[model samples]
Target: MDELGIIEQGVDWRTRLGQDIRDCMINDILFSLQTKLQSTSTTLIDLQKVAARIEERIHTIASDYGDYLRRICLTRGDLDSYDVLLNDCQRQQASIRSSILLHQENKQGDQIVQAKRNTMGTSSSSVLSNQVALNDHKEHSHPYEKDMISKLPNDLVQHIMSFLSMREAVRTSVLSHWWVNQWTFLKSIQLNIYWFHMDREKFSSFLDKLLLSRVQADAPMDTFELKSFAIDRANCWINHAIKHNAKVLKFAEYGKWEPFYLDPNLVELSSRYLETLELTNVALDATIFSQLANSCPALQNMLLTDCLLEVEEISSSSLKNLDIIDCYILKDLSICTPSLVSLCIKNERTDNSSFRNSYLIFATVIIIDASSVSSMELLAMDRQFTFVEKDGGEPMFNNLRNLSLGLWCINNMFSPLRRFVRHSPMLRMVTLRISPLDWKSHLTKEHQEMLISIRDRRGLILYIDWY
Candidate 1:
């Protein structure tokens, strides 16, 4: 196009004029653009001014907010200080109150102790007065002494003296006049001679004083107890208990301490009118027990502990309740009394003698303490003494109503159970325990069948507790 020289063509007439007009218009546009550019720069400068003002205002606000934050921090410190002081005051108050309560409790304890001390002192003084009164009566001699002494207004003296033990009663003679022979008439004699020499003669002499006094005094005895007494004096004391017809008798012995000598005749004589009898740690041949049962026709309750009772036939004509505890040497036990209602035997703790043969000697043995039950409990040994199947066949004790068997039993002598269930055709309930490891497996099919029959026939509950 440049080679064509189009620019040169504008030099021709009207075209040249038109070209001059366009150059003028271009100069006007350039001038207008310069004015608009200057206006835009001024507007930009105004906006910068406004932004600087706003930035200054924001800096002032931020400074004020910082002051407010400082004030809040100060207020917060004051509140924390107040809270700490208040808490300390509350703690101090609580401590003071606790101290007051402790003082009050201490005062109360002291008052109780003082009261008990005063009571003991009064009792001591009364005892001394009795001693003095008794001495005056004894020191003054008289042929009518026995009658006069008996006639004196001395019921309080006797009542007070009754509280003393056998040894203390005898020692009363050393006190004064009236006390000289006061112990001779004691009806309740409880002796505690833990250190009595086992020399037979010396013991017999000591017993002579007790016996001769009671005999001369002619007091019918209520209780005669020889607790852990020496063996030497056992004969004399046993004789005394028999002769006096004691009502409640408790005899206990332990350790290598002297053992008591027991006689069938003595037991019979004493037990004739006995109501409760408790024997612990005494060595007795089985023969004497039978005699005792016959003699104690009125016996209501009996307890035996750590004893060697050779009783093959357990018989107490009127025996209603029996309790045996840790009797290591028990052998050939039997129960013949229909009157027997409540019985408890606990041997799980420790007993040297368990079995000469199978544990089937006892009718039923229990594993746990049967004491809680109202009825008789053969307890831990419950299963041990149960019957093994004999050629004689099923036992026929149809009278059993409530029964408990132990988990340790072998030779599943459901014999006693079956017997009870059979005889007591209308039997109410029976409990059988079977230890899976026990040698007896009769508690298997046959036992279950018998249980089902009993349940169906008598509507009896057959409970089986497995070990």
Candidate 2:
């Protein structure tokens, strides 16, 4: 009996000792991991606090700004509808004779289309010419049929002169009684005022006379184009025309100008009942952009140039095509739009060291397509955003079918592309827009090889454009 007890006690002792060693080993490993994890947690918490403080500062800075930011902010809120809106807006037929007025087979595939050089002039004839030189010399002198054809139906004349400039239409009015009243009722009032044509004062005078007459005479102005200049006159002109519900507005001011501010009341309007708005300016502010995102409910197409949209995050469920060109002061870009199809984001650099701007520096611009967005074009001339040695990133986008980008975005391109490529394995067409070939001449042989290495792996459409 004593021998049996001793055997049992030894067995129990062995099992207990084995368990103690196992537990001790686990505790030692766990203690080391806990120490490492604690250090990491502290670092993360510190980062989070810094980020929060930076964000707070950004908000405070913007809030402290004058109405300058408020006015130039791109928004469609509270726009006041005024002056000349079309009488027959419900009338769907643009014209009874629906024929292809002009069609030019573009040779420039997909370059930043030369502004004036690219647009096709509307004409009744089959040929596409730079000018339709049909001037009756009599008002300068008139053709014999001027008196008779002048009485042609108002709608017919409106249709006929839809393609003609306001100057041509004014001259046409001098021809006959029939044309006089119709010219005053033009459906589209084009203010194609070139800076080269007149000085600033002279331009302002012309705009005032034209806009006042349109409002006073109640012209059916549907489209406005005074994109070349940025005077107080242009501001007033846009202010008036937007009230009239001009559907197609273009102001591509690629040329530089003296920096100026806008009237805040102008930005905060209630009458942005249009489909498209294209603005290329010196710079844009944040609030106006936010107001616009809030106000413009039916907007379809939008373009921004050399501008800044402070909306940090953009969410448009109805917008289709968005073009951000040379916009440097954009950060915190978050967009979730179902109906968005084409998105083109150009220069995305911020030279300023403001936290909002810096955070936006290498931050990823994400795009989600629940709608019909098939085409994506991103053009960056240089490393758009500022980055430090430990900036810790590259740009990334997901679910894009057609991706177009400039090859030099470096971390901005590679990081995002790597993730996007993996996430969107079904991406079909990727286009790379090559800038002036002058870039290649200065690059080292190794750099060129590295570029080739990236390209060799990803089959993409390379589009080269020479300045």
Candidate 3:
């Protein structure tokens, strides 16, 4: 081969070697993380078991104290202290569970990286072997170069930082002066509080400082996500991000039952650049939707899960996709998003929740005014549901192409599935999924007949699956 060809082969070999080394490092890191995660999980489980045993013992003590332990001097405060200890243990358990979930997310990313590494290894090994001879001859010609990653432009470094978690990205500052400030220019910031071994106050303070620094640097934040148990303290920080034109905003609770409430003012101010918004375990009122439609012209997608909807109606215009999951407090849903292409409503069952109280009675009505919707999914559990259609007008989902209904929807007195098939002239597919409990009992012969009738008449396919 010519000198140029040999040189090119050597360079390629070096590149492949670097990539292989990086992949090996990544594998080592993943192995270490998995080991630590397993250890932490075992410890947390042990703590929970101990806490349960302690509680059982305390119960026995309380029961025997009134009669047999009167001779001793154990007061109610002692029992209360035991209860407090149990609560602390429970809190720690919850934090560990959250951390586990965060690690699981990272595990998926690691799998993707591993898959790429495997593909590269398979394709480059022969080429690398052939270049070994060329490498010896070119050793003096091309001396060891500076790290290519360190030589990357600031913009490229910032772009790379976008894929990393905020904690990992910020830690890159320790590498060199060039990277010390590059993380501040990152467009995406995603942090899970439980992943860091800091107290809530310190995490909050860190977020405050980070957001403040970004604002001072005039950085354009494309995404801002925070998952924490204590979101009340970060309300101001969220508001700041919205005001600064963050395009995507996501906030979710870590381990609390109570829903977080975002003031209407905050939602209203989040209109400018917010294209996607996701909130879990949030308490919302009726006016939240209308406020978004009027204020957030750029908004396209909204997801509310495990939330407490304190109102009867939800309506929007600018939103293109809407997802309402595990929100039991909403008695009615009114969507008027002309831009909507997809809608999903799901229920999370709770034994003693208010949603259960309306089981034997009419509970909620869903009215959709979106003419552009092409996909719809509903899982209302056992609640009574009514869909409002315009009087003496065409049905809303005339353009809908896909539809899904849960077990409760099949039992609705309104026959929502039949109505959907009758109205949705463009519907190409229908899927019906039932819970295991419902499938064993509630799936009737009549339901099967209805499914066959739709397929024969509409010439459409049907699917039934257990969920």
Candidate 4:
């Protein structure tokens, strides 16, 4: 036999077949890697397109509704929803960018493996060893190359986490060892039922664990905002926040029928650092308000919306801004804050006639003692304008500079405007927001003539808003 024939006969047929099968498997794997690379590239392109569209939409919203958005944010504090959307978009973009980088690295790895297979004579074991070594080296040298956010400073990462809801913030712990427990240091703790997506029991347990963990960590609680269904542990959470010297405390109940009542003992707890207190759909008694007025010396801003107030008076010395909207007052309401700078009272009722009759015939009168109030807005369109000064001697708003009134009848608007101008010497602008239900009365020739006469005679700036 010839030399090649003798060599072929010396090699076992089964071994040769095994080697052929191994080579074919390696080729298949390389082909699969190439296909994956192409797929990843396509996915990257699609993600880029999605990201570009999202950016365009965001820009359009900002440009088209900037003023309207500002108004809403200033009046209702609804900016958190918009912020959540923006943060989610940003997180998606970051994840897509990281995925693209990881795919490119994987493609490079595939190219290296293919090059090795071509030059190294298809020794599968040797090729895999080399690839493993290369991967290990890259992993050790640049662990966070794919995830750039991991390389950010801890404080910046914590700041980013602050914008996320409590559940989302806690979920970051599973990303890697470096992220473990990083969310525990967040200053702003926002717990909303919509974020948890859990039953009441699970939510309560999670909340307890989260709060306990933060309390153990001694994390600074700058803002503690809670929006949820009425829970029994809510009082405990509020006490914890107060104990931690929370600066801003907001508690809103989502259930309209089952209103959350503040624990009377909470008012006894001294919140020396509490600057803002906002309560919605909560029931409050007179003793709680009286205690809060005395206990929280730093309290400057207070907002109560859709609340059940069994209190006759709200007295606070350090309050700067107060807003009471659509609250059910069981008796005559009195506000006697001395340091108040701005006050807004708004009530939007469905049955205007009945509400007007009930409100007026109940002999309920709103008394104000805020002499330092500069800006005032009273928007109870159904009720007649009546405000009694505390001592009944001087104008209530001695420092009032701006006044906005929502009037149901434009013909009767002149009297309130004249009275306000007479009482408020520093008042420079009066904005009359005509109620939508009274638009017919707003466009009358007599009303326009009266407005002109008031402006000409009083030398006051009048802005008529028909909405």
Global lDDT of each candidate: 0.49, 0.48, 0.58, 0.60
Which of 2 and 4 is ahead in lDDT? 4
Q: After superposition, how far is residue 211 of candidate 4 from its true place, in Å?
A: 1.3
Residues 1-467, candidate 3, lDDT per residue (tens digit)? Answer: 23432223333333323334334433443343234223323221222322233222223323232221221112222222222122464577678667755555676576564443333322222222222122222221113544345578867777678787655564554345355556656788777665443235545656676677677778887888888653455567678778878899998864232345666655554457889999886767666755676788888889988776666666666778989886655344455677789988866555443212311222464655767889988766645445667678677677799888777666544276788777788999988877678666875777667668868888888887676
Q: After superposing candidate 1, which stretches have Cα over 4 Å from the reference? A: 1-184, 195-208, 256-259, 264-271, 329-331, 351-374, 380-383, 386-402, 408-467
Query: What order do candidates take by TM-score, descending?
Result: 3, 4, 2, 1
Assess candidate 3 and give its TM-score to the true structure: 0.64
The CA-based lDDT of model 4 is what? Answer: 0.60
Clashes of each: 23, 18, 0, 0
> What is the per-residue lDDT of model 1 for residues 102-121, given as tens digits with 9 covering 90 to 100?
55566656656444333332
Using TM-score as the measure, the top candidate is 3
Q: lDDT by residue for model 4 over 79-146, one digit each (tens)? A: 11112232454466568557655545666566564443344323222222233222212222224456
Model 3: number of backbone collisions: 0
RMSD of 2: 24.0
RMSD of 4: 25.7
TM-score list, all predictions = 0.49, 0.56, 0.64, 0.61
Instruction: Kindly list the per-residue Cα lDDT of model 2 for residues 1-467, writing each as its tens digit.
Output: 13332223334333323444334433443343234223323221222322233233333333222211232121101111111112232122234123222222333443323221223223211111111222233241234443677557867777888888765665554456444445545677654434223233444555566566667777766777765443544555666777787777666442323112334455452346767877765344555556557777777888876654545666666689888776644454556667787887776545432211322324445553333566777675533422112124432333457867665443433554445444444466655555455456544566556446555666644344444
